[model samples]
Each structure stands twice: as structure tokens, then as C-alpha cells.
Target: MENAERKELELFAAKMRRWIVEGVYCAKSGHPGGSLSCTDIICYLYNKEMKVDPQNPKDPDRDRFVLSKGHCAPALYSALGLKGFFDINEMKNLRKIDSFLQGHPCIEHTPGIDMSTGSLGQGISAATGMALAAKLDGKDYRVFSVLGDGEMQEGQVWEALMSAAHNKLDNICAFVDHNGLQIDGNVDDVMSLGDIKAKVTAFGWNAVEIDGHDFDQIEGALKAFNENRGSGKPFFVIANTHKGRGVSFMTDNASWHGSAPKEEQYNIAVGELDAKIKELEG
Candidate 1:
């Protein structure tokens, strides 16, 4: 990417971080660490990678995204809002009664959501199914799914991984948010996902590891996957990321995993994000 485009992505990521923090703080009960960690990846996909239409959201040939780490709904919701999926003001209503934005994603209730997912390990299965359906229908649409490293403890994820590889779903790309932390604590301490790349590669998928927050590496990986599609394999991008990426106090702090920021903390996060946004604008 050019310097200008890179700056644009950086600005988008910064704005997304602010939105995630604001949305979670407003709700007073939502995931922040995972949301912050995954913001850049989400911005990359929604802003540049995915072939989507906010205007024609239900277009059959449009690409699909599944947030397998469904607790990170705040990140997805913020992205959707910025992408014009809904009014930006709706973000403040997150996790409230009768709001389209639920604590976990619900496709029926949400506009841009392709799948209703909250269960730890069920989303990958839905994404695999979508990819299979596209193949059966001979459509060129691709499917992307993001999973939390901790959520890999669920056996159902392995089942979906095996299925995607066995069926040779080349149009499907999955990401592992290897942030090293979960709700309770670190993933390695809670339940080690030993050699995630090796495990997926053994299941017959093309796997690449990259710094999840690096735009250049992420763009390169996605481009490479697109170039190699239909080579009789699935694609996995292992995104090594900080648990709470942008905020100084929250980074890698397990306590922030699901905690809403207090008022003072919210002001700090918003201030930091606003300064970055202003710098980009300048």
C-alpha cells in the first residue's frame, strides 16, 4: 500500500478503536480487550479486503464475514456502523433492550451480520457451510471468519477446520486472534492451543502467520490467498495481536477482557483516540 493509503487505514483503525471503547463504555457491559485487539483486522477487511456493499447488503455474490469470537461484537458493530451498515448513533444503544446490536451477534436482528453466533465454537461451522454453499452454487463469493485463540479450546472448531480442509474450500479464509489472553486469563495458562499453525496445516489448509496489527503484512497475506485460491486448500491467517491493542492501560490486561471502561478510563481512551485521529487528519 502507498503511504497515503496506509495512513488512511491507520486513521480508520484509530477511529474504530474509539468507537469500540465508546460503544462498550456506553453499554457498561461488553468485551473491550478482544474488541480492541481485533479492530485493525476488522478495519482492513471492511475497508479494503472484503467485496461488500453497504447499500446492497443482501447481494448474493457479496463476500461474507463471520465473527467466530462472537463476544467481540463491539468491534464488528463499530465496523459495520463506520461502513454505513447503520446509523452511527446506534452504537450507543449496544447491548440494550430492543437494540439491533446485541451483546452477541444475531443475524436476524442485525443488518450486516451473516450469522447469529454467540456459542464459542459454532461460528466456524456456519462459515464453512457458507463456503460450501457458494461452491455448490458456483458463486465466486468468499467467506472470512475470525476466531479467538482461546475459543480454539472448543472441539467444534476442530470439526469445522477438518471439514473446511477435507472439502477443499479454497474460497474460505479464517483468522486466529492469537492475543494470548481469554476471559479468565492467558490462553496458554487456561488451555494451551499448541502449535495452532501446525495443527491447521496438518488438517490440509494453507496457513500463514503475521503481525495482526500490521496493515502491510495483512494486505500481503490476503492478496496472496486471493492469488492462490482454488488450489485445493483452505487458508488460515494466524494474527498475533495484543489483547487490548490501542489503549495503554488495557493492553494485555486480562481484567479488561470483558470489563467496560469506567468514566475516567473512557475519557482517557477517547482522548488518546481523538488525538491520533486529529494527527491523521492533519
Candidate 2:
């Protein structure tokens, strides 16, 4: 990516982090650590890569994305809101009573959501089905999905990967947010996902590893996926990321995995993110 473009993405990601923290802090009941961790990848996909139109979100020919790790709906909703899918003010009402933006994504409520997701492993299955549908219908649209590192432990995720590869679903490109922390604690302490890339490659996927926070690497991996299509293999990206990426106290802290920041902490996080955004934008 060019310097200017990289800066723009960085700014967008910063704003996403700000919004993620703000929404979770207001709700006092949603996951912020993983949401903040995956904000960059989501921002890049919506802002630069995916051929989606907020004007016509249901456009069949447009690319599809699934937040398989759906607890991170704050990030996805923030991305969608910034992309013009809905009013950005909706973010403040996250997890509120009868709000469209719930704790998890609901396709019926959200304009840009391709599938309702929150069941950990089910979203990947839905994404695989969408990819297979595109192939069966001979459509050119691609499907993308992001999974939490902790979510990789679900047996259904591997089943979906196996089906994607066996069906030769090259239209599917998946990412694993390898932040290494889950709700209870460290993913290794919970259940070690030994050699994720090797396991996926053995299942017949073409895998690429990259730093999830780096715009250059994120853009490069996405471009490489597009350039290397038609190889008859599903693509997997292992994005190594920090659990709480932008804010100081949250970074790699398991306690922040699903806890909302208190008033003082929220101020600090927003202040940090605003400064970063200003620096990047300037």
C-alpha cells in the first residue's frame, strides 16, 4: 500500500477502535478486546477490498463477509456504520433494549450483515455455504470471514474448512484473529490450538501469515489472495494480533476480553485513539 492510503486505513482503524470502546463502554456488557483487536482487518475489508454498496447491501453480486467470531459485532457494526450502511449514532445504542445493533450480529436487523452470527462455529459454516453457492451459481463474488483464535477450537470450524477445500471453494477467503486470548483466559491455557496454519494447510488451504495490525501486510495478503485465485484451493490468513490492540491498559489483558471499561478508563482509551487518529490523519 502507498503511504497515503496506509495512513487513511490507519486513521479508519483508529476511529473503529474509538467507536468499539465507546460502544462497549456505554453498553457495559459486550466484548471489546477482540473487537478492538480485529478492527483493522474489518476496516480494510470494508473500506478498500470488499465490493459492497451501502445503498444496496443485498446486492447478490457484491462480495460477502461473515463475522464468524460474532461477539465482536461492535467492530463489525462500527465498520458497517462508517461504510454508510446505517447512521453512526446507532453505535451509541449498542446492546440497548430493542436496538438493531445487538450483542451479536443479526442479519434481519443489520443492513450489511451477510449472515446472523454468534454461535462461534456456525458463521464459518454459513460463509462456506455462501462460497459454495457462488460457485454453483457461477457468480464472481467472493466470500470473506474472520474467526477468533479461540473460536478455532470449535469442531464445526474445521468441518467447514474441510468442506470448503473439498468443494474447491476458492472464492472463500478466511482470516483467524490470532490474539491468543478468550473470555476465560489465554487460548493456550483454555485449549491450545497447536499450529493453526499447519492444520489448515493440511486440510488443503493455501495459508498466508501476517501481522494483523500492519496495513501494508494486511493489504499485501489481501492482494495476494486476489492475485493467486484460480489455484483451486480455499485461502486462509492467520493474522497475528494483540487482544486489546490500541488502548494501553487493555493490550493482551484477558480481563478486558469481555469487560466494559469504566468511565475513567473509557476516557483514557478514547483519548489515546483520538490522538492516534489525529496523528495518522495529519
Candidate 3:
């Protein structure tokens, strides 16, 4: 990617981080750590990778994205809003009784959401089914899904992976946000997802691991996936990221996983992201 393009993406991701903090703080209940960690990848996908149109959201041939780790709806919602799916200000109303932006994605209500996903491991299955349907219908759209590292413990994710490979869903690309910390604590302490890359490769998919926050790695991984198309297997990218990535106090902190920040913390997060945005913009 060009330097200018990379800077633009960095700025966009920083804005998304601010939106995540704003939404969660306003809701007083929602996940922010993982949401912030995965913002860059989602921003890159929506802004530069996916062939999605806010104007023609239901276009069948458009690429699909499912946030398997759905509590991170704040990130997804921010991306969708910035992509012109809805008024970006609606993000501040997150989780409100009258707001369309719920705690988790609601496909029926949200314009950009391809699937309603909140259950830990179910979104990947839905993404796999979408890819299979595309193949069956001789369509060219690709399906993408993002999963939390902690979510790796769910057996259903493995089942979905098995099905994706067995069905030869090469059009599907899945990302495991290996951010180490979950709501409880370290993922290893909770349940070890030993050798995630090896496990995915053994499941008969192409696997690559990268630094989740690095735009170059993120872009390279996607390009590599495109280069490897027609290989008759699904693709998986294990992205090593820090929980609560952009905020100083929240980084790698398990307690921030599902908690709303207090006023002081929220201000600090916004301040940090603002400075980062300015740095990138310069």
C-alpha cells in the first residue's frame, strides 16, 4: 500500500476506536477491548477490500462480512456508519431501547450487517453457509468472518472450520483475533487454544499469522489470500493483537473486555485516539 493510503487507513481506524469508546461509554454496557483491537482490520476490509455499497447494500454479489465475535458490534457499527450505511451519530445511541444499534448486530435492522451474530462460535458457520451457497449458485462473492481468540474454545468454530474445508469453501476467509486476553483473563489461563495456526492448517485450510494492527501485514495477508484462490481450501489468518489496542490503560487488560469505562477513563481514551489521529493525519 502507498504511504498516503496507509495513513488514511490508520486515521480511519483511530476514528473507529474513538467511536467504539464513545458507544460503549454511552451504553454503559458493551465490549470495547476486543472491539478496539480489531478496528483496523475491519476498517481496512470495509474501506478498501470489500466490494460493498451503502447504496445497494442487498446486492447479492457484494462481498459479505460477519463479526463472529459479535460483542464487538461497536467496531462493526462504527465501520458501517463510516461507510455510509447509516448516520454515524447513531453510534452514540448504542444499546438504547429505541436504537437500531443493539448490543449485537441485528441483520434485519442494520443495513450493512450480512448476518445477525452474537453467539460465540455460530457466525463462522453462517459465513461458511454463505460461501457454500455462493459456490452452489455459481456466484463470485467472497465471505469474510472475524473471530475472537477466546472464542476459539467453542467446539462449533472447529466444526465450522471442518465444514468450510470439507466443502472446499475457498471463497471464505476467516480471521482469529489472537488478542490473548478475554473477559475473564488470559485466554491461555481460561482455555489454551494451542497452536491456532497449526490447528487451522490441519483442518485443511490455508493459514497465515500476522500482527493484527500492522496495515502492511493486514494488507499483505488479504492479497496473499487472493493470490491463493482456486486452491480448493478455505483461508484462515491468525492476527496477533493487543486487547484494547489504542487506549493506554486498556491495552492487554482483561477487565476492559466487557466493561464500560468511567468518565475519566473515557476521556483519556478519546484523548489518546485524538492524538493518534492527528499524528497519522500529519
Candidate 4:
């Protein structure tokens, strides 16, 4: 990426982190760790990868994205708001009693959500189905999704993977947010998803591992996904990320997985992110 583009992405990701902290703090409950971990990918997708229009969010030919790791709705929702799907101030109402932006994605309510997902391994299944449907309909639109590393333990996820590869759904690209931590202390401790890349490759996906925080690597892997469109195989990107990124106390800490920050911690997080944004601007 060019210096200007990289700087723009950095600033956007910082602002999104602030939004994540703000929403969770105001709601007094959420999964901030994974949300922060995946914010960059969401930033890149909404900014550079996906073909989405805030004015016509449901255009049939537009690319589709599913947050397979749907608990991180704060990140996805913020990306949508930043891209003008709705008012960015709407984030303050996240998870509120009457807010359309609930804790998880709901396609019925949210404009940019292509799939309503929160039930663990089901999002990938839906994405795979969407890919197959697109092929059947002779459409060129692609399907993109993100999965939690801990969610790799699900048998249903493997089933979806196998089915996608078996049917050669090359139009689909997905990533594993391998943050090494889940709500439980560590993902490997709770359940070891040994050699995630190898496992998915064995399942017949064209897979690659990369630093999830790095925009260049993310774009490279996504380019590889695009190249595989006619190769009769699906693409899986194993993105190594920190569970709680962009905040001091929360970074890599599993406790922040399903808990909101207190007022002091929230202030600290917002302060740090604001500083980063300022530096990027400078």
C-alpha cells in the first residue's frame, strides 16, 4: 500500500477502535477483545476490498460478507457506519434496548449485514451456501467471511470447509482471526486447533498465514483468493492477531473477551486510540 493509503487505513482503524470502546462502554457489556483484533480486516474490506454501497446496500450484484465470528459486531457495525451506511453517532446506541445494532449481526435490521449470524459455526455454512447459490445463478459476486480461531473447534465449521472445497467455491474467501485467546484463557488450552493452515489445506482450501495487523499481507492474501477463482478451490486466510489489540490493558488478554471496560479503562483506551489517530494525521 502507498504511504498515504496506509496512513488512511491506520487512522480509520484507530477511529474504529475508539468506536468499539465507546459502544461497549456505553452498553456496559460486549466482546471487545476479538472485536479489536478484527477491526483492521474490517477496515480494509470496507475501504478497499468489498464492493458495497451505503446508498444501495442490498444490490444483488454487490459482494457479500459474513462475520462468521459474529460476536464482534461492534467492529463490523463501526465499519458500516464509517462507510456511511448509517450515522456514525448511531454506535453510541449499540446493544441498547431498542437499537437496531444489536450485540450480533441481524440482516433483517442492519443495512450492510448480508447474513444474520451469531450461532457459532453457522455463519460459514451460510457463506458457503451463498457462494454455491451465486455459482448456480451464474453470478460473479464473491462471498467473504471472518471466523474466530476458537470457533475452529466446531465440527460444523469443518463440514462447511469440506463442502466448500468439494464443490470448488472459489468465489468465497474467509479468514480465521487467530488471536490465540478466547473467552476462556487460551484457545489452545480450551481446545487445540493444531496447525489451522494445514488442517484447512488438507480440507482442500488454498490457505495462507499472515500477520492480521499488517494491511499489505492482508491485501496479498486477498489477492491470492481472487486468483483462485478459476482454480476449483476455496481460499482460507489464517490471520494471526492479538485478541485485544490497540489497547494497553486489553491486548492479548482473554478477560476482555466478553467484558466491557470500566469508565477509567474506557477513558484510557479512547485516549490511546486518539493519540494514534493524531500521530497518523501528523
**Could you give candidate 3's per-residue lDDT for residues 105-182 as a string of tens digits?**
999998999999999999999999999999999999999999999898999999999999999999999999999988
Candidate 2 lDDT tens digits, 146-196: 999999999999999999999999889999999999999989999999998
Which residue segments of model 4 deviate by more than 4 Å? Answer: none
Error of 4 at 116 (Å): 0.8
Which runs in model 3 stand beyond 4 Å of their true positions?
none
Clashing pairs in 1: none
Model 4 whole-model lDDT (C-alpha atoms) = 0.93
* Better structure of 1 and 2 per lDDT: 2
lDDT of 1 at 234: 92
TM-score of each: 0.99, 0.98, 0.99, 0.99
TM-score quality measure for candidate 2: 0.98
Clash count in backbone of candidate 4: 0
- Cα deviation at 201, candidate 3, in Å, is 0.7
Candidate 3, after superposition: displacement of residue 191 in Å? Answer: 1.1
Local distance difference test scores for all models: 0.93, 0.93, 0.93, 0.93
Output the TM-score of candidate 4.
0.99
